[model samples]
Target: MSILLKASDLKTPMSASDLFSRTGPLVFEVGFGDGRYLEHLASANPEWNLVGAEVSLGSVWRAYRRMNRSGIREVRLFKGNARFLVRDVFEEGSLDRVFVNFPDPWPRKKHLKNRLLQVPFFQILSSRLKPGGSLFLTTDHPEYFEFSVQQGQESLCFDVIQGPPPPATLETKYARKWRDQQKPIFHAEFRCHTVIPSAPRPISSIEMQHATLKGSLENVGPFTKQVRRFEGGHAFVMEAYRELDSQGLLFKVISEEQDFRQELLIQAWPKKDGVYVSLQPFGDPMTTKGVREAVLAVTDWLVSQGLELDQTWV
Candidate 1:
């Protein structure tokens, strides 16, 4: 069976020992495009546990099929942001090595901030690495490579070593394509020399228990779709759904912030004393600052419709 892991499969700030059920060397590959290198590493080193993180579902599926066919039981896949996975899931000083190959360069000057190898990323990577752990990166983009090197040096947690791309990493599709075109490939090995503590995660868990609101449920009509802009982010009521049994109303809320986003369902049910507004348990959405804002947005909308907001516990 495929060892592809969903977000819910992991606990916030998970440990490597818990994940593999044993303690051994652990390696991670960020942006495992096509999974060639990851597969090679897994097959080549059966003693070490391998974890692959990729955002593309198509690439994830392809990698999953390849690993399944090869009976590679040591490999696991995560489909989401690598930063979040590293910062929120992996324990400190847990990773033996990390590989990032051919990440998007985001060549435009205006989009440089979007690049993955910034100073903040280097700090987080350093904290996640073991005492002697190293990060191996290969890219055909010279500017990005140089930028990454500079960032690593500035972080003071790693000693950058410039070298030729590793043989296994060159097996990737992007590496082969770039090599075929005679483009110069840049490689860097950032050896972690010190530990850098990462900041606490903003959202601790994806599952929200409940929220209570003290307000009347009457006259809660005209729940049309609308968007509200707040100080740091925005919330949008994507749609409203009436319960088939006429018990309550479900509002689909989309919350957006600079670094976080989630689509949650907020339920407005009538309680004995007031309306109970809470996140629907079935959506399995992460409780974030934006999500809390979304709940407040719904409550404020209800108040605007004639209900008075006496209290809120979200």
Candidate 2:
């Protein structure tokens, strides 16, 4: 099984043409809520690349599993906001088709800024879309649909139209609701006419880490035993595993490098007692020395805290 690394980890990327090497043209859908429409499209168009962006963890997990089981090899799914992937991972003119379907309306006057059809969003679409690439947008809310159209025209990258696109996409949950209520599912197809604009460059490392960590913390949980990737991978998860008791406050570290092998490295770091430190080396034996050095560097910087550190325990 492929390891689902933290959001901060590396991802496999390819050139715009190579992105759809195994598949066909890369068709991307952002804010793919309840994903029934994505299912219909990917299943129907097996030759095309199907990329989905979903903010909900359960939604992403479900959609990925469903598409994989459907034998849709061209699909790639991300469990994060659309902005992070578009502004960071994708290059200019990388996508063939972009979809924004029934995003959060943010109806309150104070909350309207949170809607997905803001000015910067149109700019991003302009950068990602190919020279004749089409962006398909749909919303049940008339106000948001008009707002999106206004923003697109103001950006001067898209000429908006109301109705079906060249090749119509499928229907989702919100669209079904609109149909039942006799409410029109407002639609538009925007064609990129000229050179795409460049985004404000990628953020700095500090800003980048802050962005990725926000997504990673969504799946954090309590664990004592090591959580390996697919029961055979190197990545280990240690969560809430270092609580110190007043009595026997020994820290145990466990690692799994490969299948059928588990190594346990126990480091007994006790304050007001050098016996435990003498029994075992002060270093965190489970990790490499380089990681050990990093731990020491961080711990050594905390000397000013009210909590005192022993001469040798980390």
Candidate 3:
């Protein structure tokens, strides 16, 4: 199995057997910055499956190289919001331990909403953790640590306990930076006391579909930026480009559903009978309702421009 995993590599309800060569326990690290702590976990527990999520592409590549150099095999890494894995992928009671090492505090009052470890997330995390499983958090920011504990308490699923920082956590890049300045690091463990029911999944897997519009580009009117809102999300058609060679049109679209956001392109090209409107697979986006609605919105715009809506599968 490859060390790097994409969003599509994950199943709706992920299984441990499919992820690791040998699974003694499943450990997940959120925003595994430079991956030093993740490497530590994998090296110390070769029998365990160490899964990590990182949003930065540079960090993902750096971590991938570090793991390769160490010849680590019982690990898998994902480059996206870790919440998606916890909320939509992992099966209930699948996680043994979770780690959050020096996560961004989002200290400003206005940006507090951007902070992770909120009450809803704590509840979701509680559902995924096995009985007695705990989420270990180590950070230099005292306020964030206290906020997380209070949020976990509000969830009513965990017993927050002050604890010593893990050895691996102290050696991370951020940890070393803080240590050089003699800043105090706080550690806590939120042990699961009661496993709540899994929260409803806001995003789901769907097959991307195309629409067959019975019209010609010559008959279509000028394109304009459009926005469409659906049940759980919204999409924006940001720009349109006309292909000079084939007279095709491509639209750049952005969609947001919950915490997940996707930017993709939809192409409208002439066919034998009509114009074929479909999503271009340039970004490897997970086909979700928002993305499907993006295509629908584009097709609807063409219809408003006088194109005949022959059929649509979105």
- For 153-244, candidate 2 gives per-residue lDDT tens digits of 88777878788532333357767677788886677877766545775344222211000000111122332434333322332323223334
Segments of candidate 2 deviating more than 4 angstroms: 1-23, 165-170, 199-241, 244-314
- Candidate structures ordered by lDDT, highest first: 3, 1, 2
Write down the RMSD of candidate 3 (Cα, Å).
Answer: 2.1
Per-residue lDDT over 1-314 for candidate 3, one digit per residue giving the tens place of the 0 to 100 score: 78898655667678787787665899999999888998998888877898999889999999999999999878899888888789877788889999999999999999998888999899998889999999999999999998998999999999999988978899999999999999999999999998889754745677857999988877565667899999877899999888888989999999877666678899999999999999888877778887789889999899898889999888
- Put down candidate 1 lDDT per residue, 12-84, tens digits, no spaces: 6777766786567999999997788888997788888888888888999998888888888887897777877
The CA lDDT of each predicted structure is 0.80, 0.54, 0.87
Separate clash counts for every candidate: 1, 0, 0
The C-alpha TM-scores of every prediction are 0.82, 0.63, 0.92
Give, for candidate 2, the lowest lDDT window spanning 10 residues.
208-217
> What stretches of model 1 exceed 4 Å from their correct place?
199-202, 205-208, 211-236, 243-247, 255-261, 270-275, 286-293, 310-313
The number of the candidate with the highest lDDT is: 3
RMSD of each: 3.4, 11.6, 2.1
Give stretches of model 3 more than 4 Å off.
Answer: 199-204, 218-224
lDDT of 1 at 250: 87
